[model samples]
Target: MLFRNVISILLIFGTPSLVLGCGFPPDLWCSSPEISEKCGVEKQCSLWHSKQALTDVPLVRYELYYESLCPGCKQLILTQLYPAWLKVQSIVNVTLVPYGNAQENKYGGKWNFTCQHGPAECVGNLVETCILSILPFDKAFPFIHCLETYNPSTDGKYCASLYNLLSYWPSIEECSTGPNGNSLEHDMAVKTNALNPPHQYVPWVVLNGVHNEEIQSQAESDSLALICNAYQGVKPAGCTKTGFIRSPVKKIL
Candidate 1:
């Protein structure tokens, strides 16, 4: 399926509402107490988190359901998602689901997966899943972007090293190669399958827990604008109305 050619299928919430933390999603990058305590001052996360919290502004939800090795998925991640995230991360609750177009079956008392790209892609998915599970969103996302930037099909130790995350690689390796990874991928599968209208392609973008043609097109073309427009509270500097129009994101490939 083409990346920009989105199928407008609406999906229902398949899981219970996860508890929000620090006025946003628990997995939100820098708003939680633990994250704030650890790196808030260093990262200057307070400027964004405190602003949103004080204003009682609800964060715009942005979710991407994609596979590891899909070219279009990589394009969106590298060009659109990552760049837009850096600009609007504070006002957006971003969720990355890596298992896409993959089927699961129980055989020999174990779960087996068939990925869209190949076995390598399944491994890539596990690596990403392990990364997301091991680190908070703030740390996990950069590593993921690095992985996609270089090569998603290989072991992600290089990306981990880039982020001083080698200390956590052993745990990530263990989880990815064992039952932990399987369970995580299964949860992803459940979420992907639960789409009310069922996703028709990878790089499926959902806005505010709902998916449609207009939102998907807007997200793929310029996710920053999409998030900024969807936001209901104070606009971030990038999305300010002081004659600062965000340039349209150019497709990398």
Candidate 2:
């Protein structure tokens, strides 16, 4: 009976749904050169923030704690975040946290929660977390960028195939929408729920644990510039050419 009950929580479908988001903090994230890249060069499958970061190097940690289906979240990912990745994939590491402002009510191994955008957002977050679990960012981010294009509410499965990630969709879906999926989200909640100052809204954008109000304000138009500015390493040529150093981003407490 205990085993069966545990299974129920792990596999239980969403009985209800919720929403969640961003906030301020400090050092915000530490760097440990002792730890290697978040994922190794060989390309092991793991969560986005899996590895320990090297603080000594010039690195800008862009962590987006967001809900899946939020309109603003969708816009920023496609415009600012995606383009930023293309330009600075070598210099920056972006962490996508799907447990926006939502609360997770744990039942055994199963997690029941609600999202602001409704059930779809909750479902979408699970799907995204599952993808990151198995695929590295280079392969996974493209599919995610495309999935949001057609509206995740209805075309999540189709987008997977469209982006050529179809081969992995079966496993992805099984883990995302099932007990396995629940387990992943539960872990993510543990991380997101512990944000230092707590989030005020979705797309709670942070750079190295520092929430920059200025960058968040102009994320779409100036994200790359902001990241480039935060970069402490040797500046890229593009940074000089643009002549656009974003205004200092303010970190909230």
Candidate 3:
């Protein structure tokens, strides 16, 4: 008999809804503010207190490095991990780092990595980070909702659609050419090597200045668990089957 560990957290109103799908069943979590309509008063009050305690803690900066084309990155973001981050919004400074040059190359109109996709990249990262940075817990829901419904694809129109969805607009020519032309490519290669030190994979996530390789391995569940553990301080027990273990967050930090 295989025993799966399912952690269920009931988030009361006023709490950011993170951890929607990582390891907890979606049915077990509720976002509605009316406690009477969603959960018992006792559970609601308890969750409220927990949320307060969580919010009082100092925020930790976390960077997630991923490729736009990687399915594992998509899974981790759209699934429970991202939701969990939402729950702890007051305590997390989340940064989305687009790792690797492939997707940017494939979409941003420049094959060689030239131009200042830096502003675009920085914009996207800062938007998410800013919401998590300044918005009240209850107000950040729409961003997460939009991210959940995002379509992950690299086809010209598909990528463009997502960019627009994020309110990220590239020039018509830039859209056709890609994010980083030859110039950005040269800069990225140099920067990635300086930062990531050249690994053999893609989708590496840096959490609190720690880079976990699970993303590169396409270990979606494992990466999610590792991310959860990093933020929640609870070791994930069921992710070994998915190929993740307790390792350094990379040597860069």
lDDT per model vs. reference: 0.75, 0.67, 0.41
Candidate 1 per-residue lDDT, tens place, 1-253, comes to: 2111111110121222222222343234343556444432213344444444536878888889998888778878887778888887888889999988999997775679999788999999989988899999999999999988887657488998889999999999899999888899898899999986689888888888899988877776777788888888767787753222333332212
Q: RMSD of candidate 2 to the true fold? A: 19.6
lDDT of 3 at 228: 43
| Backbone clashes, each candidate | 0, 19, 29
Candidate 1 ranges beyond 4 A from true positions:
1-54, 241-253
Q: Give the winner by lDDT.
A: 1
Give the lowest summed-lDDT range of ten residues in model 1. 2-11
Each model's TM-score?
A: 0.74, 0.70, 0.40
Q: Counting only residues 3 or more apart in sequence or on different chains, how many pairs clash (N, Cα, C under 3 Å) in candidate 2?
A: 19
Model 2 bad stretches (over 4 Å):
1-56, 218-220, 237-253
Ordered from best to worst TM-score, the candidate numbers read 1, 2, 3
Model 3 lDDT per residue over 1-253, tens place: 0011112233223333434223434333333435323434335445544554565544556555544434455555665346545454444576554434333344454333321234443333323333333334344434433543453222323433544433332332243244333343434444455555444444455556645455433224444444445554322243223333333322211
